[model samples]
Target: MTYCVGMVLEKGLVLMSDTRTNSGVDNISVFRKMFTWQVPGERIITLMTAGNLATTQAVISQLEERTKEPDERDNILLKSPTMFQVATEIGRLMRGIISERQDANGVKGRGRFTASIIVAGQIKGMEPRLFMVYPEGNFIEASLDTPFFQIGETKYGRPIILRGYDRQMSLEDAAKLLMVSFDSTLKANLSVGLPLDLQVIERDTYEAGHQHRIGHDDSYFAAISDGWGDALKNAFHSLPDYSFYRPDD
Candidate 1:
């Protein structure tokens, strides 16, 4: 399992994903779940993937291959005129790969493979956009009402976002909020272990303003984890307790 989140903010986009995959308790491994492509000053794109690892890898590989081939069909890097189209192409690719794999293996319902992707970037002459692509090749754009999207092992980390998210928050605050969310998931879930990959894209720049791989020993993340826990405990204790409780009420 994995955890991935893509947030659309007034500043730009913030993406975070864990790097763990597990077949069983004894068989666990790490594989990067985030992929990025950039044309420097022209365009920058990032994708966070979750669900069937094989399907996601194949989709990414096919897209990469197309980008390398001059005569190949329009791939994620070339075919899409806007961030919207890029998301559509990625969704289509994901569905196509899953269908082909199922047919070849004859696994039917038992081996159904699926994946979800968060696509965010900007093309020259257009504004930055973020999209969440479903397994069926359909997607929705992030708007003011829904400014973020998450996939894979998401339930553990969603509440922080729901409670703290604000469209006008500074990128620094947004990144910190996401780290706290990740901290919550890491503490509660064994499947979502890290070295987390994070990228922050600033508006109109068409480049990643900050990108880093946070490992188990990362000091800043450690501080955030400890600080948040202490703060939460303090707040819980400070909340007014039930004063009129009755044993048989």
Candidate 2:
């Protein structure tokens, strides 16, 4: 499992994903779940995936193949004229893979091969957009009413984002908000461990804005982990003490 989030802000977009994957308590490995594509000054597209590793890798590989194949100018991501079209194409492709897996297996209940994706980026003339694509190939875009999306083991972290996210906030502030959410998720879930990927795409630039990989030893993240814990404890203690009869009294 993983935790991936993408936020749409007045300034642009912010996305982050954790790198841990596990089959059981003892079987664990690290694999990047964030991938990005940029066509210089034309577009910058980023994808963060969560769920079955094989399905996500296959979807990514097919998209990459379309880019590298000479005869295929049909790379939907590189060639799409609008960000909406890009999201649609990705949904189609993702749905196609899951359907193919289900059909091939002949026995399908919940369908073991499942994955969800968060897509974010912009084309030169278009505003930045963010989307969450579910295993069924359907998606919902971030809107003014809901300015962000999350996938994979998302419950533990969602409350913080819901409380703190603001469309008018700066991209830097957005990153900070997500870090808090991610840190909260990380602390509660052993399945979602560290080493995170973060990317920012400023509107209209059609270029990568800020990109970095964070590991457990990172000083800033360490500070956040410690600080959040302390803050929560302080907040809890500061609340009114329950008025109960005491044995001493």
Candidate 3:
């Protein structure tokens, strides 16, 4: 299991993903779930993945290979003229892999080769965009009505983003908001452990502006975790006390 989020903002895009994967309580390990490809001033695409590790890794490796060997181009990430095309090609690759695996294994392999992906980036002369691609190879884009996407262990942290996300917030603030959300999830689920990879793509820059890893010992993340816990306690206490025995009763 993992936790990954991609947010769209007026300023640009923010992406974060945890690095933990486990077969069980005793077999936990860390593997990077975020991958970025860029053409500097032309385009920058970031993808965060969750689900079957092998499925995700194979998809990523194929995409990377296309970059190195342009002659094998069916649909290269850099060759795509728009972000939509980039996502379509990725979906095609992922779907093909899952389908091939399932077909080879027959009925028992139905859900075994599943995965999900969040794609976020900007192409020259266009507004930054964000997408959540499903295991079925279909995807939905982020817009004013839906300005963010999260894949993997999402339920635990979704409320925080729902309450705090602002379309006009700075990239810095968006990162902070996601940190709190991830902290909440981290506390609730042992499967989604740190360190987390965070990246910010500022609109029109066509490149990642900020990239970081927040480890277990990172002071800033520690502070945010502690502070959020304390703040929640204070907020809960601040609400008016409920009275079972009221005068009207």
Candidate 4:
């Protein structure tokens, strides 16, 4: 399992993903879950993937290869005139790949090749956008009502985002919020171990403002984790005590 989030804000986009893959408790490894392509000042796209490692890697590889081959049909980087179209293309690719794998394996029920992705970026003349692509090649864009999307082992971290997210918050605050969410997930689930990848894209810049890999020993993340735990505990204690002593009966 993995955890990945893509958030759309008034400022731009913030994306994060963990890099752990495991077949069993005894077998574990780290593989990058974040991928990016940029055309200098023209456009920048970032993708974070979750679910079956083979399926996700295959999709990313095909997209990368298409970018390199000028004659390839409607590759992710070339054919999409808008961020929406880019997401559509990726969804189509993911569905096609999973279907082919399922057919080859003669599998029934949900196929083992299921996966999802978060696609976030901006084009030269368009507003920044973020999307969550499902296994069936369908997707939903982030809107004012819902300014963020998360994929993969998400439940453990969602509450933090729900309580803390602010569309107008500065990128620095957004990053800190994500760190708290990720720290909570890491503490609760062994499958979501770290060496996280994060990207911040400022609106209209068509370039990534910050891209970083946070390892287990990153001091800032450590501080955020420790501080968030203390803060939450303190808040819990400060809440007004329940009126259980009121003897109405």
Measured by lDDT, the strongest candidate is: 3
Per-residue lDDT tens digits for candidate 4, residues 1-249, read 899988988889999999999999889999999988888688999999999888888898777665466665445665579988888888988998999999899976576889999999999999998889999999998899899998888899999899999999999889888999999999999999889999999998888789899998899998988898889999999998778677674
- Model 3: weakest 10-residue lDDT segment is 66-75
Q: For each predicted model, how many residue pairs clash, with residues at least 3 apart or on different chains?
A: 0, 0, 0, 0
The segments of candidate 4 whose C-alpha lies over 4 angstroms from its true place after superposition are: 66-75, 247-249
Which residue pairs in model 1 clash with each other? none
Could you give candidate 1's per-residue lDDT for residues 196-237 as a string of tens digits? Answer: 999999888877779999998999999999899899999889
lDDT of 1 at 3: 89
Candidates 2 and 4 compared: the better one by TM-score is 4
Estimated TM-score for each candidate: 0.92, 0.91, 0.94, 0.94
- Cα RMSD to native, each candidate? 2.5, 3.0, 2.0, 2.0
Model 4 poorest 10 in a row by lDDT: 66-75
| Cα-based lDDT for every prediction | 0.87, 0.88, 0.91, 0.89
- Shift in Å, residue 235, candidate 4: 0.9
Ranking by lDDT: 3, 4, 2, 1
Off by over 4 Å in 1: 66-75, 109-111, 245-249
Query: Of models 1 and 3, which has the larger TM-score?
Result: 3
